[model samples]
Target: MYDLGDIVEMKKAHPCGVNRWEITRMGADIKIKCTGCGHVVMMPRREFNKKLKKVLESKADQA
Candidate 1:
């Protein structure tokens, strides 16, 4: 499972030319911030699962 502050790679690239995003919030919906353009988007977990490529780093990993 993904938690807040995790950096992840998406299956597709963002328009801003970044595949990396940081998880800012989690619940029934998930909120992620784009690392390149700094855009924030909120979507359901199912949609997130479809879009996510892999978890690059988690808070624990960073620590």
Candidate 2:
């Protein structure tokens, strides 16, 4: 499962030309930051799950 501060790769590219995002918040809604444009977005968990490709980095990875 994904949690806050996790870096994930999406199946699709963003307008900023990035496929990676950093998870900033979690719960029923998830907030993520674009690695390319630094834009932030908040979406429901179901949407996030649909867009998610893979987990690149997790909280444990930081430690």
Candidate 3:
């Protein structure tokens, strides 16, 4: 599961060639920033959830 500040890997790489993204915002939609090119993308929660492959880090675990 993903939450704010989670670093996740997408099933496919971004056009910028980065598959790793950081979750900066979350709600009905999820916003992620590319770890390689600093690009940002916003997608609906359902789609994002489907595309999510791995959770590299969890914000909840930081506390």
Top of the candidates by TM-score: 1
Model 2 Cα shift for residue 59 (angstroms): 1.9
Per-residue accuracy of model 1 over 1-63 as CA lDDT, tens digit each: 678899999998899998999999999899999999999999999999999989999898778
Model 3 C-alpha lDDT versus the unseen true structure = 0.92
Better structure of 1 and 2 per TM-score: 1
> TM-scores of the models, in the given order?
0.92, 0.89, 0.89
lDDT, each prediction: 0.92, 0.90, 0.92
Q: What overall lDDT, based on C-alpha atoms, would model 2 receive against the true structure?
A: 0.90
Model 1 weakest 10-residue run by lDDT:
54-63
Q: By TM-score, how accurate is candidate 1?
A: 0.92
The residue pairs that clash in candidate 2, if any, are none
Deviation of model 1 at 8, angstroms: 0.3
Model 2 regions more than 4 Å off: none
Stretches of candidate 3 exceeding 4 Å from the true structure: none
| Positional deviation of residue 44's Cα in model 2 after best superposition, in angstroms | 0.4
Please give, for residues 1-63, the per-residue lDDT of candidate 3 as tens digits.
Answer: 778989999999988877889999998989999999999899999999899999999888998
lDDT of 2 by residue, 1-63 (tens): 777888899888899898889999888999999999999999999998998999998888788
- Candidate 2, after superposition: displacement of residue 53 in Å? 0.5
Alpha-carbon runs more than 4 Å astray in model 1: none
